[model samples]
Target: MAESTQQKLVCSRAKAKSDTGSSVTQSSSAPKRKASTALPLDMKVRCVSSIPVGPLVYTSRRMQGMIIEWDEFGSEQYIELAELQSMRNSSPAFFENNWILIDDEEVLHFLHADKYYGSAKSIDDLYGILKKHPNHIAQLVKTLPDHLKKTLSIVAYREYTAGRIDSIGVIKAVERATGLSILSN
Candidate 1:
Protein backbone atom coordinates (compact mmCIF):
# COMPACT_ATOMS: atom_id res chain seq x y z
CA MET A 1 0.00 0.00 0.00
CA ALA A 2 1.14 3.48 -0.78
CA GLU A 3 1.36 6.11 1.92
CA SER A 4 -0.18 9.54 1.71
CA THR A 5 2.05 12.64 1.76
CA GLN A 6 -0.43 15.07 3.41
CA GLN A 7 -0.84 15.08 7.18
CA LYS A 8 -3.52 16.70 9.30
CA LEU A 9 -2.50 18.90 12.20
CA VAL A 10 -3.93 18.62 15.69
CA CYS A 11 -4.30 21.58 18.03
CA SER A 12 -4.25 21.03 21.77
CA ARG A 13 -5.94 24.31 22.67
CA ALA A 14 -8.30 26.29 20.48
CA LYS A 15 -7.02 29.65 21.73
CA ALA A 16 -4.82 31.13 24.46
CA LYS A 17 -4.67 34.74 25.78
CA SER A 18 -1.28 36.37 25.32
CA ASP A 19 0.36 38.92 27.70
CA THR A 20 -0.33 41.66 25.19
CA GLY A 21 -4.08 40.87 25.15
CA SER A 22 -3.71 39.09 21.78
CA SER A 23 -5.06 35.56 21.11
CA VAL A 24 -2.59 32.81 20.11
CA THR A 25 -3.05 29.24 19.00
CA GLN A 26 -0.59 26.44 18.64
CA SER A 27 -1.01 23.91 15.80
CA SER A 28 0.97 20.67 15.95
CA SER A 29 1.22 17.88 13.40
CA ALA A 30 2.23 15.30 16.01
CA PRO A 31 0.02 14.00 18.78
CA LYS A 32 0.35 15.68 22.17
CA ARG A 33 -0.09 12.55 24.27
CA LYS A 34 1.19 9.01 24.07
CA ALA A 35 -1.09 6.38 22.66
CA SER A 36 -2.61 4.00 25.16
CA THR A 37 -2.26 0.24 24.68
CA ALA A 38 -4.08 -2.76 26.09
CA LEU A 39 -2.33 -4.43 28.98
CA PRO A 40 -1.64 -8.19 29.22
CA LEU A 41 -2.22 -8.69 25.53
CA ASP A 42 -1.80 -12.08 23.95
CA MET A 43 0.88 -12.36 21.33
CA LYS A 44 2.34 -15.04 19.12
CA VAL A 45 5.99 -15.75 19.76
CA ARG A 46 8.34 -17.51 17.35
CA CYS A 47 11.00 -19.28 19.40
CA VAL A 48 13.78 -21.44 18.02
CA SER A 49 15.12 -22.98 21.23
CA SER A 50 11.92 -23.37 23.21
CA ILE A 51 9.10 -25.86 22.78
CA PRO A 52 6.52 -27.35 25.07
CA VAL A 53 7.38 -30.79 26.37
CA GLY A 54 5.20 -33.35 24.64
CA PRO A 55 5.02 -35.88 21.87
CA LEU A 56 6.69 -34.98 18.61
CA VAL A 57 4.35 -33.74 15.91
CA TYR A 58 4.89 -34.44 12.22
CA THR A 59 3.96 -31.95 9.54
CA SER A 60 4.46 -31.41 5.80
CA ARG A 61 5.96 -27.94 6.25
CA ARG A 62 9.70 -27.19 6.06
CA MET A 63 9.85 -27.69 9.83
CA GLN A 64 9.01 -31.37 9.63
CA GLY A 65 9.35 -31.96 13.35
CA MET A 66 8.01 -29.76 16.18
CA ILE A 67 9.98 -30.69 19.27
CA ILE A 68 12.66 -28.37 20.60
CA GLU A 69 14.70 -28.25 23.79
CA TRP A 70 15.85 -24.89 24.99
CA ASP A 71 19.03 -23.91 26.85
CA GLU A 72 19.89 -21.17 29.35
CA PHE A 73 20.77 -18.63 26.69
CA GLY A 74 17.58 -19.33 24.71
CA SER A 75 19.57 -21.34 22.18
CA GLU A 76 17.55 -24.09 20.51
CA GLN A 77 18.39 -27.80 20.51
CA TYR A 78 16.27 -30.44 18.90
CA ILE A 79 16.39 -33.69 20.77
CA GLU A 80 13.97 -36.54 20.29
CA LEU A 81 14.28 -37.82 23.82
CA ALA A 82 12.24 -40.98 23.21
CA GLU A 83 14.17 -41.87 20.07
CA LEU A 84 17.45 -41.11 21.79
CA GLN A 85 16.64 -43.31 24.74
CA SER A 86 15.50 -46.19 22.55
CA MET A 87 18.61 -45.84 20.43
CA ARG A 88 20.79 -45.83 23.53
CA ASN A 89 19.19 -49.02 24.77
CA SER A 90 19.48 -50.75 21.44
CA SER A 91 23.12 -49.75 20.83
CA PRO A 92 24.84 -49.21 24.16
CA ALA A 93 28.23 -49.04 22.51
CA PHE A 94 27.16 -46.00 20.49
CA PHE A 95 25.52 -44.14 23.39
CA GLU A 96 27.59 -45.21 26.40
CA ASN A 97 29.58 -42.26 27.78
CA ASN A 98 28.43 -40.11 24.86
CA TRP A 99 27.59 -36.51 25.70
CA ILE A 100 24.51 -36.50 23.42
CA LEU A 101 25.49 -33.12 22.10
CA ILE A 102 24.26 -32.79 18.50
CA ASP A 103 23.70 -29.85 16.18
CA ASP A 104 20.14 -28.55 15.78
CA GLU A 105 20.32 -28.72 12.03
CA GLU A 106 21.60 -32.27 12.24
CA VAL A 107 18.75 -33.13 14.58
CA LEU A 108 16.29 -31.74 12.05
CA HIS A 109 17.99 -33.71 9.30
CA PHE A 110 17.90 -36.81 11.48
CA LEU A 111 14.22 -36.21 12.21
CA HIS A 112 13.55 -36.13 8.50
CA ALA A 113 15.73 -39.18 7.89
CA ASP A 114 17.31 -37.35 4.97
CA LYS A 115 21.03 -37.52 5.67
CA TYR A 116 21.74 -40.83 7.41
CA TYR A 117 19.27 -43.58 6.62
CA GLY A 118 20.80 -46.63 5.03
CA SER A 119 21.95 -46.52 1.39
CA ALA A 120 19.04 -44.55 0.02
CA LYS A 121 19.27 -40.89 -0.93
CA SER A 122 15.79 -39.98 0.37
CA ILE A 123 12.52 -41.41 1.56
CA ASP A 124 11.24 -41.15 -1.99
CA ASP A 125 14.09 -43.40 -3.10
CA LEU A 126 12.98 -46.04 -0.59
CA TYR A 127 9.44 -45.68 -1.90
CA GLY A 128 10.76 -46.21 -5.40
CA ILE A 129 12.43 -49.39 -4.22
CA LEU A 130 9.14 -50.61 -2.84
CA LYS A 131 7.40 -49.67 -6.06
CA LYS A 132 9.78 -51.80 -8.08
CA HIS A 133 9.83 -54.72 -5.65
CA PRO A 134 9.12 -58.12 -7.17
CA ASN A 135 5.97 -58.62 -5.12
CA HIS A 136 4.40 -55.27 -6.08
CA ILE A 137 1.40 -55.51 -8.38
CA ALA A 138 2.11 -54.17 -11.86
CA GLN A 139 -1.60 -53.47 -12.48
CA LEU A 140 -4.52 -52.48 -10.31
CA VAL A 141 -6.11 -55.44 -8.55
CA LYS A 142 -9.35 -55.83 -6.65
CA THR A 143 -7.45 -57.25 -3.69
CA LEU A 144 -3.83 -56.32 -3.01
CA PRO A 145 -1.48 -59.06 -2.03
CA ASP A 146 -0.51 -59.59 1.63
CA HIS A 147 3.10 -58.66 1.04
CA LEU A 148 5.61 -56.36 2.74
CA LYS A 149 5.79 -54.12 -0.32
CA LYS A 150 2.02 -53.71 -0.49
CA THR A 151 1.79 -52.98 3.23
CA LEU A 152 4.51 -50.39 2.95
CA SER A 153 2.73 -48.70 0.05
CA ILE A 154 -0.54 -48.56 1.94
CA VAL A 155 1.15 -47.16 5.04
CA ALA A 156 3.00 -44.60 2.97
CA TYR A 157 -0.10 -43.34 1.21
CA ARG A 158 -2.13 -43.19 4.40
CA GLU A 159 0.55 -41.36 6.36
CA TYR A 160 1.31 -38.95 3.54
CA THR A 161 -2.35 -38.00 3.21
CA ALA A 162 -2.63 -37.57 6.97
CA GLY A 163 0.39 -35.25 7.04
CA ARG A 164 2.35 -37.73 9.11
CA ILE A 165 4.78 -39.26 6.66
CA ASP A 166 8.01 -37.57 5.61
CA SER A 167 11.55 -38.70 4.96
CA ILE A 168 11.84 -39.59 8.66
CA GLY A 169 8.62 -41.59 8.78
CA VAL A 170 9.65 -43.50 5.68
CA ILE A 171 13.01 -44.42 7.19
CA LYS A 172 11.38 -45.26 10.51
CA ALA A 173 8.95 -47.57 8.73
CA VAL A 174 11.80 -49.34 7.06
CA GLU A 175 13.56 -49.67 10.42
CA ARG A 176 10.44 -51.08 12.04
CA ALA A 177 10.06 -53.61 9.23
CA THR A 178 13.70 -54.66 9.53
CA GLY A 179 14.37 -54.03 13.24
CA LEU A 180 16.98 -51.28 12.90
CA SER A 181 17.59 -47.78 14.30
CA ILE A 182 17.74 -45.14 11.54
CA LEU A 183 18.87 -41.91 13.28
CA SER A 184 22.13 -42.61 11.50
CA ASN A 185 22.85 -45.17 8.85
Candidate 2:
Protein backbone atom coordinates (compact mmCIF):
# COMPACT_ATOMS: atom_id res chain seq x y z
CA MET A 1 0.00 0.00 0.00
CA ALA A 2 0.96 3.44 0.94
CA GLU A 3 4.32 4.56 2.37
CA SER A 4 2.65 7.29 4.42
CA THR A 5 4.60 10.59 4.54
CA GLN A 6 8.03 8.82 4.69
CA GLN A 7 10.06 6.88 2.04
CA LYS A 8 9.08 9.45 -0.59
CA LEU A 9 12.13 11.59 0.29
CA VAL A 10 14.61 8.78 -0.33
CA CYS A 11 14.57 9.34 -4.06
CA SER A 12 14.70 13.10 -3.47
CA ARG A 13 17.80 14.30 -1.62
CA ALA A 14 17.10 17.84 -0.43
CA LYS A 15 13.91 16.86 1.34
CA ALA A 16 15.58 14.02 3.26
CA LYS A 17 17.56 14.39 6.51
CA SER A 18 16.56 15.74 9.90
CA ASP A 19 16.07 19.42 10.48
CA THR A 20 16.62 20.90 14.01
CA GLY A 21 12.97 20.15 15.04
CA SER A 22 10.77 17.30 13.81
CA SER A 23 9.88 13.72 14.67
CA VAL A 24 12.91 11.57 13.77
CA THR A 25 10.77 9.60 11.40
CA GLN A 26 9.25 12.62 9.61
CA SER A 27 12.53 14.50 9.25
CA SER A 28 14.86 11.74 8.12
CA SER A 29 13.07 10.33 5.13
CA ALA A 30 16.06 8.37 3.91
CA PRO A 31 16.21 4.62 4.11
CA LYS A 32 17.46 3.45 7.46
CA ARG A 33 20.70 1.51 7.45
CA LYS A 34 20.09 -2.20 7.20
CA ALA A 35 21.01 -3.84 10.48
CA SER A 36 22.00 -7.00 8.57
CA THR A 37 23.80 -7.41 5.27
CA ALA A 38 24.94 -10.27 3.07
CA LEU A 39 28.08 -8.42 1.92
CA PRO A 40 31.08 -7.69 4.10
CA LEU A 41 30.58 -4.67 6.36
CA ASP A 42 32.94 -2.62 4.14
CA MET A 43 31.24 -3.48 0.85
CA LYS A 44 28.41 -1.70 -0.91
CA VAL A 45 26.60 -1.76 -4.23
CA ARG A 46 28.55 0.98 -6.01
CA CYS A 47 26.93 0.04 -9.28
CA VAL A 48 24.16 -2.25 -10.42
CA SER A 49 24.95 -4.60 -13.27
CA SER A 50 22.43 -7.08 -14.57
CA ILE A 51 24.86 -8.82 -16.91
CA PRO A 52 23.41 -11.81 -18.61
CA VAL A 53 25.26 -14.88 -17.33
CA GLY A 54 23.15 -16.77 -19.83
CA PRO A 55 19.87 -18.54 -20.57
CA LEU A 56 16.40 -18.77 -19.10
CA VAL A 57 16.61 -21.57 -16.57
CA TYR A 58 13.56 -23.63 -17.37
CA THR A 59 11.58 -24.80 -14.37
CA SER A 60 11.04 -28.10 -16.17
CA ARG A 61 14.48 -28.85 -17.66
CA ARG A 62 18.05 -28.76 -16.38
CA MET A 63 20.39 -26.32 -18.16
CA GLN A 64 24.16 -26.00 -18.08
CA GLY A 65 26.74 -23.19 -17.54
CA MET A 66 24.05 -20.70 -16.63
CA ILE A 67 22.42 -19.00 -13.66
CA ILE A 68 18.73 -19.70 -13.23
CA GLU A 69 16.30 -17.03 -12.22
CA TRP A 70 14.47 -18.45 -9.23
CA ASP A 71 10.72 -18.58 -9.57
CA GLU A 72 10.43 -16.44 -6.48
CA PHE A 73 11.08 -12.74 -6.82
CA GLY A 74 14.28 -10.85 -5.99
CA SER A 75 17.93 -11.79 -6.72
CA GLU A 76 18.65 -15.11 -4.97
CA GLN A 77 19.28 -17.98 -7.43
CA TYR A 78 20.61 -21.53 -7.87
CA ILE A 79 23.39 -22.88 -10.08
CA GLU A 80 23.64 -26.51 -11.10
CA LEU A 81 27.39 -27.32 -11.10
CA ALA A 82 27.10 -30.92 -12.19
CA GLU A 83 24.95 -29.83 -15.07
CA LEU A 84 27.43 -27.06 -16.00
CA GLN A 85 30.49 -29.31 -16.12
CA SER A 86 28.65 -32.01 -17.97
CA MET A 87 27.36 -29.44 -20.42
CA ARG A 88 30.82 -27.95 -20.99
CA ASN A 89 32.32 -31.33 -21.58
CA SER A 90 29.60 -32.26 -24.01
CA SER A 91 28.74 -29.04 -25.86
CA PRO A 92 30.41 -27.60 -28.95
CA ALA A 93 30.29 -24.17 -27.30
CA PHE A 94 33.02 -22.59 -25.17
CA PHE A 95 32.17 -20.76 -21.91
CA GLU A 96 34.08 -18.08 -20.01
CA ASN A 97 36.97 -19.78 -18.26
CA ASN A 98 35.33 -19.15 -14.86
CA TRP A 99 32.15 -18.18 -13.09
CA ILE A 100 31.44 -15.24 -10.75
CA LEU A 101 28.90 -14.93 -7.97
CA ILE A 102 28.32 -13.57 -4.45
CA ASP A 103 27.23 -16.86 -2.92
CA ASP A 104 27.87 -20.56 -3.44
CA GLU A 105 24.72 -22.62 -3.69
CA GLU A 106 26.16 -25.41 -5.87
CA VAL A 107 29.46 -26.65 -7.50
CA LEU A 108 33.06 -25.97 -8.51
CA HIS A 109 34.18 -24.66 -11.89
CA PHE A 110 35.76 -26.66 -14.73
CA LEU A 111 39.28 -26.86 -16.26
CA HIS A 112 39.15 -23.66 -18.33
CA ALA A 113 36.28 -21.87 -16.66
CA ASP A 114 37.61 -18.50 -15.59
CA LYS A 115 36.48 -18.14 -11.98
CA TYR A 116 35.38 -14.52 -11.57
CA TYR A 117 33.62 -15.58 -8.45
CA GLY A 118 32.74 -12.83 -6.01
CA SER A 119 30.62 -9.80 -5.06
CA ALA A 120 33.70 -7.84 -4.09
CA LYS A 121 34.66 -5.04 -6.42
CA SER A 122 32.54 -1.93 -6.67
CA ILE A 123 30.21 -2.57 -9.59
CA ASP A 124 32.04 0.12 -11.56
CA ASP A 125 35.42 -1.47 -10.91
CA LEU A 126 34.22 -4.89 -11.99
CA TYR A 127 32.48 -3.34 -14.97
CA GLY A 128 35.76 -1.72 -16.00
CA ILE A 129 37.57 -5.03 -15.87
CA LEU A 130 34.97 -6.78 -18.01
CA LYS A 131 35.32 -4.07 -20.65
CA LYS A 132 39.02 -4.58 -21.27
CA HIS A 133 39.12 -8.03 -22.79
CA PRO A 134 37.71 -8.73 -26.23
CA ASN A 135 38.01 -12.49 -26.23
CA HIS A 136 36.34 -12.79 -22.84
CA ILE A 137 33.64 -10.40 -23.97
CA ALA A 138 33.16 -12.37 -27.15
CA GLN A 139 32.66 -15.45 -25.03
CA LEU A 140 30.08 -13.68 -22.85
CA VAL A 141 28.16 -12.26 -25.78
CA LYS A 142 28.21 -15.55 -27.60
CA THR A 143 27.03 -17.45 -24.54
CA LEU A 144 23.56 -16.02 -25.01
CA PRO A 145 21.44 -18.22 -27.25
CA ASP A 146 20.47 -16.48 -30.46
CA HIS A 147 16.94 -16.01 -29.18
CA LEU A 148 18.07 -14.43 -25.91
CA LYS A 149 20.50 -12.37 -27.92
CA LYS A 150 17.50 -11.05 -29.82
CA THR A 151 15.57 -10.44 -26.61
CA LEU A 152 16.01 -8.30 -23.46
CA SER A 153 19.30 -9.79 -22.25
CA ILE A 154 20.64 -8.47 -25.50
CA VAL A 155 20.13 -5.07 -23.92
CA ALA A 156 22.31 -6.21 -21.02
CA TYR A 157 25.01 -7.35 -23.44
CA ARG A 158 24.86 -4.07 -25.31
CA GLU A 159 25.12 -1.93 -22.18
CA TYR A 160 28.13 -3.90 -20.95
CA THR A 161 29.68 -3.91 -24.39
CA ALA A 162 29.35 -0.12 -24.50
CA GLY A 163 30.92 0.31 -21.10
CA ARG A 164 34.04 -1.51 -19.84
CA ILE A 165 33.58 -4.92 -18.21
CA ASP A 166 36.98 -6.43 -17.67
CA SER A 167 37.79 -9.71 -19.27
CA ILE A 168 36.05 -12.64 -17.65
CA GLY A 169 39.53 -13.85 -16.77
CA VAL A 170 40.29 -10.59 -14.97
CA ILE A 171 37.05 -10.68 -13.02
CA LYS A 172 37.97 -14.25 -12.12
CA ALA A 173 41.20 -12.96 -10.64
CA VAL A 174 39.29 -10.44 -8.57
CA GLU A 175 37.06 -13.25 -7.35
CA ARG A 176 40.10 -15.02 -6.00
CA ALA A 177 41.31 -11.70 -4.54
CA THR A 178 38.00 -11.15 -2.76
CA GLY A 179 37.94 -14.58 -1.08
CA LEU A 180 34.43 -15.42 -2.22
CA SER A 181 33.16 -18.96 -2.62
CA ILE A 182 33.01 -20.60 -6.05
CA LEU A 183 29.83 -22.53 -6.66
CA SER A 184 28.76 -24.59 -9.62
CA ASN A 185 26.98 -23.21 -12.71
Candidate 3:
Protein backbone atom coordinates (compact mmCIF):
# COMPACT_ATOMS: atom_id res chain seq x y z
CA MET A 1 0.00 0.00 0.00
CA ALA A 2 2.74 2.42 0.94
CA GLU A 3 4.63 1.61 -2.25
CA SER A 4 1.55 2.26 -4.32
CA THR A 5 0.98 5.59 -2.60
CA GLN A 6 4.54 6.61 -3.25
CA GLN A 7 4.20 5.75 -6.88
CA LYS A 8 1.02 7.77 -7.05
CA LEU A 9 2.76 10.80 -5.59
CA VAL A 10 5.56 10.51 -8.08
CA CYS A 11 3.09 10.13 -10.91
CA SER A 12 1.16 13.19 -9.79
CA ARG A 13 4.26 15.37 -9.68
CA ALA A 14 5.34 14.12 -13.08
CA LYS A 15 1.92 14.75 -14.48
CA ALA A 16 2.00 18.27 -13.18
CA LYS A 17 5.32 18.89 -14.84
CA SER A 18 4.23 17.34 -18.08
CA ASP A 19 1.06 19.38 -18.14
CA THR A 20 2.99 22.63 -17.94
CA GLY A 21 6.17 21.63 -19.79
CA SER A 22 8.08 23.13 -16.89
CA SER A 23 11.22 21.20 -16.22
CA VAL A 24 13.09 23.59 -13.99
CA THR A 25 13.45 22.47 -10.42
CA GLN A 26 15.51 23.76 -7.56
CA SER A 27 18.77 21.89 -7.45
CA SER A 28 18.90 19.47 -4.59
CA SER A 29 22.68 19.27 -4.68
CA ALA A 30 23.15 22.97 -5.26
CA PRO A 31 23.70 25.44 -2.48
CA LYS A 32 20.62 27.11 -1.09
CA ARG A 33 19.95 30.78 -1.64
CA LYS A 34 19.45 32.97 1.41
CA ALA A 35 15.95 33.74 2.52
CA SER A 36 14.74 36.95 4.08
CA THR A 37 12.85 36.83 7.34
CA ALA A 38 9.11 36.51 7.25
CA LEU A 39 7.14 39.58 6.35
CA PRO A 40 3.45 40.12 5.83
CA LEU A 41 2.30 38.08 2.85
CA ASP A 42 1.02 41.28 1.36
CA MET A 43 4.46 42.81 1.63
CA LYS A 44 6.11 39.93 -0.17
CA VAL A 45 3.41 40.02 -2.74
CA ARG A 46 4.18 43.69 -3.27
CA CYS A 47 7.75 42.80 -4.04
CA VAL A 48 6.55 40.50 -6.79
CA SER A 49 3.72 42.70 -7.97
CA SER A 50 5.71 45.90 -7.87
CA ILE A 51 8.26 44.42 -10.21
CA PRO A 52 8.35 46.29 -13.55
CA VAL A 53 9.04 43.57 -16.11
CA GLY A 54 10.40 43.93 -19.67
CA PRO A 55 13.59 43.87 -21.78
CA LEU A 56 15.16 42.69 -25.00
CA VAL A 57 18.85 42.24 -25.65
CA TYR A 58 20.56 43.17 -28.86
CA THR A 59 23.99 42.18 -30.08
CA SER A 60 26.65 44.61 -31.16
CA ARG A 61 30.18 44.00 -32.34
CA ARG A 62 30.78 40.94 -30.16
CA MET A 63 28.83 42.43 -27.28
CA GLN A 64 25.22 42.54 -26.02
CA GLY A 65 23.18 45.12 -24.21
CA MET A 66 19.54 45.43 -23.19
CA ILE A 67 17.71 48.70 -23.41
CA ILE A 68 16.59 50.57 -20.31
CA GLU A 69 14.28 53.21 -21.61
CA TRP A 70 10.83 54.58 -20.89
CA ASP A 71 7.93 52.40 -22.03
CA GLU A 72 4.64 53.44 -23.53
CA PHE A 73 3.04 53.89 -20.10
CA GLY A 74 5.95 56.03 -18.91
CA SER A 75 7.27 53.76 -16.16
CA GLU A 76 10.98 53.34 -15.56
CA GLN A 77 11.02 49.67 -16.54
CA TYR A 78 13.58 47.39 -18.15
CA ILE A 79 13.56 44.26 -20.26
CA GLU A 80 16.48 41.96 -20.99
CA LEU A 81 16.36 39.01 -23.37
CA ALA A 82 15.86 36.38 -20.68
CA GLU A 83 13.56 38.45 -18.51
CA LEU A 84 11.31 39.06 -21.48
CA GLN A 85 10.64 35.34 -21.68
CA SER A 86 9.74 35.30 -18.01
CA MET A 87 7.63 38.43 -18.30
CA ARG A 88 5.67 36.85 -21.10
CA ASN A 89 4.98 33.75 -19.03
CA SER A 90 3.76 35.73 -16.03
CA SER A 91 1.39 37.82 -18.09
CA PRO A 92 1.17 36.53 -21.65
CA ALA A 93 -1.32 39.21 -22.52
CA PHE A 94 0.90 41.98 -21.24
CA PHE A 95 4.13 40.84 -22.86
CA GLU A 96 2.98 38.89 -25.93
CA ASN A 97 3.26 41.29 -28.85
CA ASN A 98 4.56 44.05 -26.60
CA TRP A 99 7.46 45.29 -24.61
CA ILE A 100 7.66 47.37 -21.40
CA LEU A 101 10.09 50.11 -20.46
CA ILE A 102 10.66 52.53 -17.63
CA ASP A 103 11.58 56.14 -17.84
CA ASP A 104 13.98 57.98 -15.55
CA GLU A 105 11.03 58.89 -13.40
CA GLU A 106 10.15 55.19 -12.80
CA VAL A 107 7.00 54.73 -14.82
CA LEU A 108 5.90 51.67 -16.84
CA HIS A 109 5.28 51.78 -20.57
CA PHE A 110 4.07 48.97 -22.79
CA LEU A 111 4.37 48.65 -26.56
CA HIS A 112 3.71 45.89 -29.05
CA ALA A 113 6.36 44.68 -31.41
CA ASP A 114 5.51 43.58 -34.93
CA LYS A 115 6.61 40.02 -34.25
CA TYR A 116 7.28 37.61 -31.41
CA TYR A 117 10.77 37.90 -29.98
CA GLY A 118 11.10 35.41 -27.14
CA SER A 119 10.12 31.89 -26.05
CA ALA A 120 8.17 32.26 -22.80
CA LYS A 121 4.61 30.84 -23.07
CA SER A 122 3.14 30.29 -19.62
CA ILE A 123 3.07 31.41 -16.00
CA ASP A 124 5.42 28.59 -15.13
CA ASP A 125 7.87 30.01 -17.65
CA LEU A 126 7.87 33.32 -15.86
CA TYR A 127 8.18 31.65 -12.47
CA GLY A 128 11.15 29.69 -13.67
CA ILE A 129 12.82 32.86 -14.88
CA LEU A 130 12.23 34.65 -11.60
CA LYS A 131 13.12 31.64 -9.53
CA LYS A 132 16.20 30.51 -11.41
CA HIS A 133 17.32 32.34 -14.55
CA PRO A 134 19.87 35.14 -14.86
CA ASN A 135 18.82 38.79 -14.98
CA HIS A 136 15.34 37.70 -14.05
CA ILE A 137 13.17 39.67 -11.68
CA ALA A 138 14.05 37.44 -8.75
CA GLN A 139 17.69 37.81 -9.66
CA LEU A 140 17.26 41.57 -9.65
CA VAL A 141 15.56 41.40 -6.26
CA LYS A 142 18.30 39.25 -4.89
CA THR A 143 20.85 41.62 -6.38
CA LEU A 144 19.50 44.60 -4.48
CA PRO A 145 22.22 43.80 -1.86
CA ASP A 146 22.68 44.10 1.90
CA HIS A 147 22.82 47.87 2.18
CA LEU A 148 19.32 47.96 0.80
CA LYS A 149 18.11 45.69 3.57
CA LYS A 150 17.35 48.69 5.72
CA THR A 151 15.49 50.27 2.86
CA LEU A 152 13.67 47.00 2.23
CA SER A 153 12.89 46.52 5.90
CA ILE A 154 11.49 50.01 5.96
CA VAL A 155 9.50 49.28 2.85
CA ALA A 156 8.25 45.99 4.22
CA TYR A 157 7.30 47.60 7.49
CA ARG A 158 5.40 50.24 5.62
CA GLU A 159 3.69 47.72 3.33
CA TYR A 160 2.12 45.77 6.15
CA THR A 161 -1.58 46.05 6.71
CA ALA A 162 -2.97 47.84 9.74
CA GLY A 163 -6.40 46.30 9.51
CA ARG A 164 -7.77 42.77 10.00
CA ILE A 165 -5.98 39.53 9.38
CA ASP A 166 -5.20 38.37 5.85
CA SER A 167 -2.13 36.23 6.31
CA ILE A 168 -3.84 33.00 5.37
CA GLY A 169 -2.87 33.50 1.71
CA VAL A 170 -6.01 32.94 -0.26
CA ILE A 171 -6.27 34.20 -3.85
CA LYS A 172 -9.36 36.09 -2.81
CA ALA A 173 -7.40 38.03 -0.19
CA VAL A 174 -4.87 38.99 -2.85
CA GLU A 175 -7.60 40.14 -5.21
CA ARG A 176 -9.70 41.84 -2.56
CA ALA A 177 -6.88 43.74 -0.93
CA THR A 178 -4.02 44.49 -3.27
CA GLY A 179 -6.40 44.38 -6.25
CA LEU A 180 -3.94 43.47 -9.01
CA SER A 181 -1.14 42.55 -6.65
CA ILE A 182 1.09 43.50 -3.68
CA LEU A 183 0.98 47.28 -4.29
CA SER A 184 -2.36 48.05 -5.94
CA ASN A 185 -0.94 47.93 -9.47
Report the C-alpha lDDT of model 1 over 17-66, residue by residue, as the tens digit: 24223422333444654433332213222222111122222221223464
> For this target, which candidate reaches the highest TM-score against the unseen true structure?
2
> What does candidate 3's lDDT look like per residue over 38-115, in tens digits?
332221110012122343322222224533334322233333333443444445544333233212111111212212
lDDT of 2 by residue, 1-185 (tens): 26744556564444443442456756679886434223332222111223344432322224433444433212333334444444356541323312222222222223233333332212333344345454444444344333322322333344435554324464443334333322223
Candidate 2, residue 164: CA error in Å? 14
Clash pairs, candidate 1, are: 49-76, 112-168
Reference-based TM-score, model 2: 0.23
The 10-residue segment with the lowest total lDDT in model 3: 41-50
**Predicted structure with the largest lDDT when compared to the true one:** 2
* Local error of candidate 1 at residue 10 (angstroms): 99
- List runs of model 1 lying over 4 Å from the truth: 1-116, 135-185
Off by over 4 Å in 3: 1-72, 97-113, 116-185
RMSD values for the candidates in order, in angstroms, are 20.9, 19.8, 20.5
lDDT accuracy of residue 108 in candidate 2: 23
TM-score of each: 0.19, 0.23, 0.17
